[model samples]
Target: MAKKKYDYSPNDFVVYPAHGVGKVVSIETQEIAGFELEMFVIAFEKDKMTLRVPTNKAEEVGMRSLASTDVVADCMKTLRGKAKVKKAMWSRRAQEYEQKINSGDLIAIAEVVRDLHRADDQREQSYSERQLYEAALERLTREFAAVGNGNELEAGTEITDTLQSRVSAA
Candidate 1:
């Protein structure tokens, strides 16, 4: 945590590796092993969950600030491209896609959304496919809303429309 002490604070939005965005609710101190240990308690409203990251181990566990605007810009560009339905099996590809969505990096998550998105005229997505798509979309929207100074619902709609209209196989 000291390595990048300036990177985070209580109430700051942070990306928990593979968990998308969460709000730092508080930095808590507790007695452990007869010594005081500090921890960061972050809450994810979307998942209705809370995570406690040790202040000493936060950086080691991949907890950090949200992606910069330039990084999100690059991700938006990635979203505005074609879906390259890979030749790999669905199970293999689904796992890969899931991993990307969970990665705290916006660009990687955008790639997952871009790859999974299907236009209106395209073939329909499977049950799991739809599930993954919704997850990626939800995750991306929350982070984008936080950075863009907008509400989550608005961000979610924009992301949905943005990805759908941004690309086409034709």
Candidate 2:
């Protein structure tokens, strides 16, 4: 097999499309079916879960380095934009929101956050809506924390504050 082009070192924060931000704990070589495979051992701190992804398959699986500062800034700006909630049925919207969260695209996740965010004066969210919102928020905040030199809770609060401020200013 050809070598993978990406260079992810131990301790590097990487985004796995389905999982969000995880740290590379180590790289290990293992023998499976007589083939030696190199794997990346990634730890998701919040989930307390670890995953081993084949190094050669990283790119194919959508594993990527943390978003650049410019991309992160753009995502933050996306959060400040007006919510673009569709008039579709709740089931369809829920599926779309789940897709955006799993896409690991920072700005797309921010769009989910913006659309689902509830202001203090607004009505309470449906349970499903609350679940999707929190999932998107957690995914976005994990990436934010990875790039913002802060913890997840801190980044989450920062994003929440920004969202609330934007809502009030509008």
For model 1, residues 78-168, the per-residue Cα lDDT tens digits are 8887776789999999998887776666787888888888877779999999999888888788888888885988877777777867753
Please name the candidate that would achieve the greatest lDDT relative to the true structure: 2
Name the regions of candidate 1 deviating beyond 4 angstroms.
1-6, 33-35
For each candidate, what is the lDDT?
Answer: 0.82, 0.92
Q: Write the per-residue lDDT of candidate 2 for residues 35-131, one digit (tens) a residue.
A: 9999999999889999999999999898999999999889889999999999999999999999999998888999999999999899999999999
For every candidate in turn, the CA RMSD to the true structure comes to: 2.8, 2.2
Candidate 2: clashing residue pairs, number:
0
